[model samples]
Target: MSQTINYQAQSPTHEIESKPFDEKNQVEHVNDVSAAKELSNFKMDAMEAEKAEHNMTVLEAVKAYPWACFWAFVMSFTIIMESYDVFLIGNFLALDEFKRQFGILDHNTGKLVIAAKWQSALQMAGQLGALIGVFLAGPLTSKIGYRWATIVALIAMNATIFVMYFADSLPIFFVAQLLEGLPWGIFIANAPAYCSEIVPIKLRAPATQVLQMFWAIGSIIVGAVTYHYNPMSGKKAYRIPIALQWMFPTPLLVLMFLAPESPWWLVRKGRLEEAAKSVNRLGRKSRLNANEIVAMMRRVVENEKEGSISYLELFKMPDLRRTLIVSGVYAAQNLTGNLIANQAVYFFQQAGMSDQTAFALGLITSALQMIFVMLSWILTSYYGRRPIYIWGTAFNTVMLFALGIAASVGKSNAASQAQASFGLIVSVMFTFAAAPVGYAIIGETGSIRLRPLTTGFGRAVYYIVEIPCIFLASYMLNPTGANLGGKCGYVWGGTATVCLILAYFFLPEMKGRSYRELDILFHRRVPARQFSKTVIGPEEDE
Candidate 1:
C-alpha cells in the first residue's frame, strides 16, 4: 500500500494535479470532491469491500475461496479437449499414420503432406465455426447463464467428438473440426468470464489464467499420446488421439452440473437471492458478507447502464475502447507466431530436425509451457497486466527475429538446431508473458453488464485475426507450398512488432481493480498507463 494520499478537489474544474503511483492498491483514497459526488454510500461500501478482497494474499484467497477455485477449474477442464484436438491437427501432420490416412503424397518432396490449401482450410474452418459460435455464446450465456451454456455446449461437443473419433477422410475431419469449434468457442469465452465472476478480485487473475494452463496440459496430453503412438502403424496412431477427446466432455459435464452459476450473472438477472446463495457457496470461508457483495454486484451492473447487453453496446463510447483493447490483445496472441509454436512438431521437422527429435522437442516445449503458465501466475500477482503483456510481446518479438536469423543463416545442423531451440523458446516466452495474462485481461476489461458479450466479441476478433494467420501458417510451413520454414518467423516478427505497440498503448492495468473501479476508470477516460496510478475510490453513477 502506498501512503494514504487523498484527492481534494478545489473546484469542479480543478483536476487531480498530483497522482500517487499505487499498483497494488489502485483506489486507496476517495477525497476528490467531484469524484466523491460520484460515490454513494453503497458504492463506497462496494469499493471498500473490493479493496479488502483484492488485498487478500494468495494463501488467504486459496483458503477462503476453495469453492471458487474448484468450480472454475471444473468449468475450464473441458477446454483441455479443445486444445488437445487443436494441438493434434498440427502435430498429426508430422505423424505418418495420420498422413497416410488424411494427407496426399507430395511428389515434389517424396513426403506425404496435408495440402497447403486444405491445411489452411481446415484451420480456417475451425476459426470460422468458432467465430459464429462466439457471437452466439453472448446471447446464449446471457439467457441461460455460463453453467447452462457450458452444459449445452458440452452436449454439442460430445456429438462432434464422435465425428472426430471416426473420421477417415480429410473432408470428414474438416467438417468435424468446424463443428467442434463451436463448443470450443463457447468454452473459451465462458471459462474466463465464469472464473472472473466467481472469484474475489485477488483470485481472478490466477483463475482466468488457468485456461492457458489447461491448454498447455491439453497439448502435453496430445504430445505424450502421439509420441507413444508414433511408432505404431495404421489408424491407431491418429485414432487413439481422436478417441481421447471423449474423455473430456463427460467428466466436465458432471462437474458443470455440480458447479455454481456466476453470482454476478444472477445479480444482473435480478435473482438476488440466488446470487447471494451462489455467493455464499463460493465464499463459504470468506470473512465478508454475501448480501453486501451482492449489492455491490448489483451496483456495478447498473452503473454500466447495462440495459444494452447486445453487441452494439460494445461499439459505444467507453465500452468501445474496452472492446478494442480486448480485441487487439487477443489478436496479438495469433500475431505473436502462435501457429509456428503450436505446430512445432511439423515446423521443427521442416527446419531439419529428425521426426523423433521433433516429437521430443514438441513434448518438451509443451511441458515447459504448462510450467511457465504456473510461473506466470506469480508474475501476474506481482506485476500489472499491461507490463506482462507489453513486455511479453516485446520479448516474443525479439525471439521471433532471432529465430528468423537462425533460419536465414541456412539449415545447417547447428542452424537447424538453433531454429528448433528458438522456436521452443518463443513458445515458452509467449506462455510466460502474453498467453495466460491475456485471459485475465479480457475477463476484466469488458463492462460488467456486457462481460459475456465483451469477451465473446474479443474472441470473435481473435478468430477473425486467426483466419489469415492460419492461411499464412499453412502456406509458409507446408513443404508443398511456400515452405519458408524458419523464415516464416520474419513475417510474424513484423506482426509482433505491431502487436507490441498496440498493447503498450491500449492495455490497461487490471491487476488489482474490481469491476466497479474499472468501470469508473474507463468511464473517466484515464489513459492506459495511468490506470494503476489514478485513484478513483468507489464512485457513484451519474
Candidate 2:
C-alpha cells in the first residue's frame, strides 16, 4: 500500500497547490500523475527560494560589498598600463623624436616616418606575445592561483619596461614590446574574472567597467606626456613615457600581495575551507553570509563536476555556442573601427593637422572616452547590457558611415578632414558604451569549471581576429599603403552592422544573473530574449 503525500509550490509571484496523491484507492495512472505533479511543485518552490536569496537591489549590494568594490578598483589599475602602452606607441608615431630614433627619412617630404613593415611588426609582435600569454594564463592561474599569476605577470612587465627604456635599436624595442605583452595578456584575461567573482551580481557590470575607465585615464596621461615631451629631441621623449609604465605595476605588485585570492577559484580547487575564509575576507564589509555563499558556490561546483566537460568539449554543441559568443563579441569590438581610431594622432597628422594639434586632439579624445566609460558604468548598472550594445552599435555604424562620407568628400580640405576626425572621435565615444560590457559578459558567460580555459580561448580568438584587422587597419591608415584615410570607415562600418545583428540575436540578458543561474539557463537552452523573464534556481538540472 502506498501513502499520500501533499506538496506545495511557492513562487515569488504566486503559489501553486498540489492535490494529495492517494495510491491505495486510486488507479495507478491517477497516482502516477499526482506524484509527478507534486514533484514538479516541490522543484518550483526550491527554485523560487534560491532566486530570492540571490536577488538584491544594486544599491543594497554596493552598501553591503564596499570592500569588494575597493578591491575591484585596485585590480582595475592593471589596465592603465595596457592603455598607456597602446597610446604611447600611437602617439610616438607622430613624434619627431620617435621618428628620428626608429623611423626612416622620407626624402620626398623631408620628414621621418616609421617604415610600414616595422610598424606592422611592432604591433603584431605584442599581439603575438599576448596571444601566447592569454593561452597560458589558464594553466598558470589554475595551478598557482590568480593573485600569484598577477604578481608574476607584473614583475615581467616591469622587466620589459626597463628593456624598452634602455634600448637604442628598433629590434630590441620590438622584442621588449613583445615580451611585455605576455603580462598584459595574462592581466587582461584574468582581471575581469577576478573583478566579477568578487563583487555581488548587481555590481559585476560596474566593477568590470572600472578596468576600461582606467584604460582611458592611462591613454589620457600618455597623450599629455607625449604632447609635452615628444617635441624634445632624442630618446628621452619616448623613454620618459616608457619609464612611467613602472609606476602602475610596482604599486600594483605590492597591493596584490595583500589581496585575497578568488573564492570561486579556491572552490574549484577543492579548497572549500579556504574558499569560505576568502568569501568572508572579501565580503567582510558587505556583511554577506559566508556559509551561504560557500554553499551556493559548492552547488555550482558540483553541478559543473557532474557534467565533466573537457577543454575539447568547449568547441562542441552547447558550450561551443558560448565560446563563439564570447570570442565573437570580443573580435567584433576590434572591427568597430577601434584599431584605426586608436591611431588618432597619426590619422590626424595624416589629415594635415600640425603635430601639436594632433596630440592635443588625441588627449581630448582619451578624456572624452574616459568620461563615456564612466557613464557606461551607470547606464549598464541601470539599463542592462543588451540595450547598450544594441544602441551603441547602431550609433557607431551611423557615425562611421558619416565619417567615411565626410572624408571622401573633403579629403583635400582641412575643414572636411577636421569633420572626419570629429566623426571618428564621436564613433569612439559610442564604442566605449558597448566595448567594456563585452569584458563583463565574457567573464559572466563561461561555465565556472571551464571559465579560465574558455575565457583564454575566447581571448586567443580575439587576438587572432585582431591580427588581420590590425594589419588591414595599419595598411589603410599608413601613408605608405592604401591610405584610405577616413574612407577606411566603410570597411569597419559594414562589419559593425553584422556584429550588431549577431549581438541582437545571440547575446542574452545576463544583466543581474549569477554564474549558477546563467549555467542553468544555458544548459536549459533558454532563448536569449527570454533570459530576463526566466527564473532559475539551483534545483534546476541540465
Output the number of the lDDT-best candidate. Answer: 1
- For all candidates in order, the CA lDDT equals 0.85, 0.78
Clashing pairs in 2: 64-286
Compare the candidates by TM-score and give the number of the best one.
Answer: 1
Candidate 2 lands at a TM-score of 0.88
Per-residue lDDT tens digits for candidate 1, residues 456-541, read 99999999998988998889888888888888889999999988887777678988887878888899999988999987655555
Per-candidate TM-scores read 0.91, 0.88
For residues 1-542, what per-residue lDDT tens digits would candidate 2 score against the true structure? Answer: 12322222234223322223343446778889999997566455435534644677888777777778888988888888877887787777788888887889776577788987777777776778889999888778877888999999999988888778887887887888788889988988888888888887888898988887887788789989999897698778888888888788889999999998888899888898898788777765345666567666766776763554356868765677788878987788787757765687887777667788878878887788888888888888889888887888888887777767777775467655655465556546654755787777887888877777777788888889887777787788777778777777788889889988888999898997777788778878888889999976466665
Counted clashes in each candidate structure: 2, 1
Candidate 2 — worst ten consecutive residues by lDDT sum? 1-10
